[model samples]
Target chain A: MKNNKTDFIQGNIACVEGAIVAGCKFFAGYPITPASEIAEHMSERMFQVNGTFIQTEDELSSIAAVVGSSWAGAKAMTATSGPGISLMQENIGLAIATETPLVIVDVQRGGPSTGSPSISLQGDTIQVKYGSQGEYQVISIAPSSPQEMFDYTIWAFNIAEKFRTPVFVMADVMVGHMREQVEYPEDYNELEIFDRKILDDPDSTEGRFLSTEVAPMPIFGNGFKANVTGSTHDEFGWRNVSDPKVMDNFIKKLTNKILNNKSEIIRTEKEYMEDAEVVLLSYGSVSRAALETVHTAREKEIKVGSYRLVTVWPFPEKEISKMSENVEKIIVLENNLGQIYPYVRSAVDGKAEVELLSPSVLGEFFEPNYILNKIKEAK
Target chain B: MLKDIEHPLQKYIRPGTNYTTCPGCGNGILAQSTLRAIKNLELDFDNIVFVSGIGCAGWIPSPSFNTDVLHVTHGRAIAYATGVKLTNPKLKVVVFSGDGDLSAIGGNHFIHAARRNIDLTVICVNNRIYGMTSGQAAPTTPKNSKTTTTPYGNMENTFDLSDLAKSAGATFVARWTTYHARQLTKSIAKAIDKKGFSFIEAISQCPVHYGKVIGMRNDAPSMMKEFKSKSIHINKIDSLSNESSDDKIIVGELVNENEKAELTDLMQSLRTEVGTDG
Candidate 1:
């Protein structure tokens, strides 16, 4: 915890508080269900902190404004749901391509097309990873509780600023709406915040884009005369659309910047994984239920542990795959229909039998008894 | 023999022009007029950020403006520029895009930006068609004027973008053709100087697909000549309703008012009033 000072607040409000602590000076969003309180609270908080806030005409403009403010050297963000995220995919791609540092807080809701508005559905787990066009990698975090919601948001901004890329905090409906006590810094100065590395000597020949190491950002209005375009460009930010070599380098750098730093970016919390024969794996709100299952199964002398992913994307394949050697079975749990199951299965390979334990009901959390019964039934 | 001296505007031009417009494209004319506006007003490139969307007109600022420029995705220039302006009020943000990029897919952003009365100088080059996409019908395309998307002649009425801006609460609104180069330069300079949202619709000549579709000589000079004869100034018009008539293109400053509060200044004021230490 950053500070012992704690306040009981909603998950969405925790997120807004974390953002304000992270020194986010600009926010633009269109309010949607399960996440509307974020914008509602953020509007008042922004004025309190002297930050700019805009309730955009639509989701596309929301993301667009965030991207624009990021370039203008502001720590900018937007909050929306699955439906709003869908509208923002194209601009998200634009942000990725331009290497803009910003945060997108998607309070995950159920949907292929406007699914349950107020339900806890982890439907957007995979969508956030692969929603944007083209080949790109983005940092994503799935906070399990309101406490994690507050903590992980600051984490998201650090990764975004360090790598100069868009990061998503995919908090689901239950995690977003549930009220809980969250510890935060009383003095904003006590909070840890990171700013993107700036290109100090723009007159030098070195360009802004580098392959493996994160390149310094030449933010707008800084007199860098930097030309940034969504079209394929070289390190100098000059347009080079036709050259395949430039295009190859562009995509490679965009993804490798995050992938190379995966060790620090990927976060997971584990309990009793060393002695467990059966493992319960989940993220976001379902992880709470997984924790309960671990407690109940332990009472029966059955070896079971809970594995919660705090940072989901740049998926922690290596750590889990290594753990799979000890576990007999890894039971994946989610409120939706096994969205992350395939990735887990592929990561586990043949070391452990991996299967998804989707909730019997679409929106409800899995009861501890149901999970333990399913684990026993597989016996 | 040519004199051994540099062109006055050469200092503002950037290095790359390999992806530039056709020899007779009006974007070239409007590009200089824009640069000239910045020069005439003595604005520094360091303090100005040019944002443009996808189109030939969008290229005016990207590689040519010799300043910080953001060439964004199609139809979102206004939204991006809004962010830039609101974030740093010291930096003058200019959005240079085309008719198709502004009034078609970007219509909502264009109108809403006007409604907010943000401090951004938006110059929409109205070439009557989607020039970069090979003359598809655009929202600003004249009704019954044939285009690739409307080969049988466009059935929809065209948008008078200046009228839309005037009604949508833009503090400054003006319409000018590329032929009115001097006035176009002055309007752009004045718009940039204005406090709130300013829109300048530059009626450019697209002599390729648009020229062939509407029966022209297929040259910039001929289309530009037509612009000179078929134009009527707003000052000469007796009634506002007839300015949108098909027979003539209305030109000159339509509206220039700065009484409304600007978005960036308002944000700054709100931040000051509430304080930043919360």
Candidate 2:
């Protein structure tokens, strides 16, 4: 028998429920606006689920603790908005270099610097991908509603574990604070949980970071006696900063683990694209407006479609390129000043003209009329 | 070539790895003292995880100690160690780092870890300068001391790290210099034996930059002599006048109360009270 339960809940609270369902037993975070509810919910809910939640001193420690807990053989996560994410970049790079499986939920507010803590803005689309100071690939999911917040958070953890890398759930203020109905499974066991691949031969003496597929992680206390470092290292996790081959092979494998597996990692939602002349490309909360714009534009005989990005980091290039070939124009809508627009334009690559509709400031979401006007212009 | 007789603590050192420190550097003594403490306690080598931050002292544990080691980013060793300890309370977690890494950049973690009374031993080597970066003024550097960054003289007052730990509610807090190797080792052993957050400040020498700039001895021996002359044991602090005692380096155990509960144990009790089993 299928057990169904639906509850009206805040998106951030749903995120906590989703993380617990996904077996996130350790949560280390510092409270930041637009993202504090996630930590607050986790603090109260974690103990009930036999999990651990630590409110760290700051964002740096939060991510660091998450990384450490992940290595200690637990599913760990941390959530923060823009400024906190900026402070966490150094450790985020460490997580990437170490190939630690953890989830970072960026409940993006406004910024280049604390632009608007209470307002909703999708300003960190590019930052989540390239915020850290090195060459690496990141996996980010953009959820458009409260239901998707619960669903995609689980997806974020599973993907983080599957690929053995840090994954981001890019949410914003509107979706985070907005209360809505979310359907959840009665038994969390029914939800899919992806456990990280562990080393079969811990004492093999071979390189731990083998450049073949996803490398198996060794827990700290499992007698593997693994030496983990953030510096450039060889396969066995020993520092070898001088060797060019070691650096090249190590970095290439780190990137290829995600890029090579793009098909399985990338996720998107497409609507009414069969014969539409213009498509509205958006993600997160802005996608809600795009969805309405598509319906309203079609009523006025404007052959417009909607493409919502679920996985924003890998950029859904294949789908965008395919859509561009069929569509006359693409209108990209975001909450910030042209963060994801360039990516859409690059993906469309002049096959179809790409127009951007971004709010001039931080606090406001896009009105349907604004997106409909862009659809009209594109048409 | 036949090997020389192995030192008693040679078993603790990682094979084929050499200490990466300047000659006459006090980090070597600090590392040896730490190993001696662990040896004295006879801790299960397999269960000991040495976590370090980004600094000269951070290198003291990793690639040197034959144990599970995590060399983390700058100033986050305690934070990382907090996670390790909480995840597996049975694992003996130790944070080994320097002054700038701990008190300067990682100050918040130090205070909060102590405030929560988390179960971990933090051994911070206070060389009074950022020796790895050719000696910048550190948080533990004496006020008005000269360094590469503070060529005009450091105007900011330095932190008394042990006092800071005591005030922050650390269950065990002690201070010792590299010259007091035996005392330092014994203090570390007692700290490890304590159940809550433990902090040991090892005032050490960076002869090259710190010594040369401060007009102290340019060699480890002379620096040790200077420390010996300036040091006053905790028991004798009352014998000296208040004016004279203000400038003296009082070295001994300052706090050793175990009434406060450890964070992990408290968390466990909370779990039990909430009727959840882990």
Candidate 3:
């Protein structure tokens, strides 16, 4: 039975297919509204691909299991909303400190604390990057449509393995529940895959944490005598809290691994920015509204362009800064009050006027006219 | 070449690793018993992984054992080990943690893992107090016991871990004191052989913190004597008087049934049923 390559699917369903296609074999999650569909879909599909799906007791165990599965040589992931992500912060820090590769899909809902379960909001943008304590670099991707939800999820897993860090696919309720057409590849092997580097000689794992770049992961029961801990340690994965220099060198390597390679980690999409005077900056589901605003404003000779942030973390400052130089004003659009607006303002560095068109209330999207009004006002 | 005659299982100990445990701590004995169990089962060293949580007991596995070890965050070893087991069911996963790590902070994970009947062995070293952070009352701390955190004496009740495990659906549940090294080792071996969630709670001695406050002698031998006096075997539970049974530390295997399906096995069967096995 030959089926059409393109199928009308929900964004969360597309995410599940992307994960399975990307070789994700372990999923542990606690169901939450808007994000529960991802878990439901994974539960139905995971075992079909010989994968494991566990509905953990809570978000903490979900992420902890994902981290464990990753170290056990399985690509793992979990999905949740804002409040769930908040509960997972500690283990997320553990994953980062231990350099475990896994994926976390934060289907963005509203709130500081369970504010709105079914509403669409980008409030978790900053939380995803800075939610966990301590200084560290993270990779977070935003998907605007169902197609990007599928494609970026696979990219998130590849980058998670490539850098040996937890990657976040920041999807919002709008995209998560939105039904749209998605094109599935005939074969998953056609996509780029990045597996963690493993040491051939297990004996060489001694002093393992010393390497600054991505360290070769050693699986348990692999005769590596691998010792993995979340505490600050030397290269051998032993706790070394006494020495200041050990902590310094260890933390530096962790942050620099992504920050120094921002060129490869950061991505953005731009439309009609070549000669626009006013540019709308957005990400996640808000980008869809920005795109519509761009089309509507351009029809009115408003000279408005849109720059969608494909990668939210590591800030994409370079691209935004360069765009800031060409535009007379930059209007940041988000579903939250103004989380990413400050970053855009800082990136612009007074090169152009920065305005925020954030719909602070839950369960609402900024209509094209609202953003067009902002663009005209900025002009 | 004159080589000192060491214990037969000394080779299983990681080379050049020194004990981080305090003197008179029973964690070393538990570690040795774990290794002895693995040795008796003739399990390949390459096929075993030791997971530990944050505490004195958590250090029992990692730098000391030659096997692969993961020293995860406080109270999360079981959850982490679940991932390891489900990802590769061939691996023999064992978790070593303390009362505070397992029952106090990680109580939710402990019960849920048991309820799911995951295939893994969890060896909980119950010392009645949190030894790693000085003396602090733990979930297994006996009522009215004194510790740094409970200078006025603890008012809370303690958990009977084996009962908790049994009620939570563990297929194999047992409790033993550090003095019952032989029995503890045999129980561990049996747990390793069990196909579902297995829990062994070792009533380890924390003489430095817990014993000193409780008026017991602050030495390993004295603690062992106390355990011998207070312990009762499970087979004799019906013979003991109610008053004596209340104070006795029940020892021996309490549950060894495996009727319920294991988590990993169920997942694999589901995959096979769906024809998704690769």
- Model 3's DockQ? 0.69
Best by DockQ: 1
* Candidate 3 positional error at B166, Å: 0.5
What is candidate 3's lDDT per residue for B1-278, written digit by digit as tens?
34877878888888877878787999988988998999999999879888888999988988788878888888999989988999999999999989999999999999999999999999999998898998888988888887888888889988988999999999999899999999999999999989999999999998888878777747878888989999988898899889878889989999999579998988888898984435
Question: In candidate 1, which residue ranges exceed 4 Å CA deviation?
Answer: A1-4, A186-190, B1-3, B239-245, B276-278
What part of the reference interface contacts, as a 0 to 1 fraction, does candidate 2 reproduce?
Answer: 0.64
lDDT of 2 by residue, B84-133 (tens): 88888888899998999999999999999999999999999999899999
Candidate 3 local Cα displacement, residue A61, angstroms = 1.0
Looking at model 2 chain A, report the run of 10 residues with the lowest lDDT sum: A203-212
lDDT string, candidate 1, A68-168, tens digits: 99999999999999999999999999999989999999898877798888987888888788998899887889987888888888888988998889999
Clashing residue pairs in candidate 2 (N, C-alpha, C atoms within 3 angstroms): A208-A235
* Docking quality category of candidate 1 according to DockQ thresholds: medium
lDDT of 1 at A276: 91
Model 1: fraction of native contacts: 0.88
Candidate 2 lDDT over residue span A260-280, tens digit each: 889999988888888888888
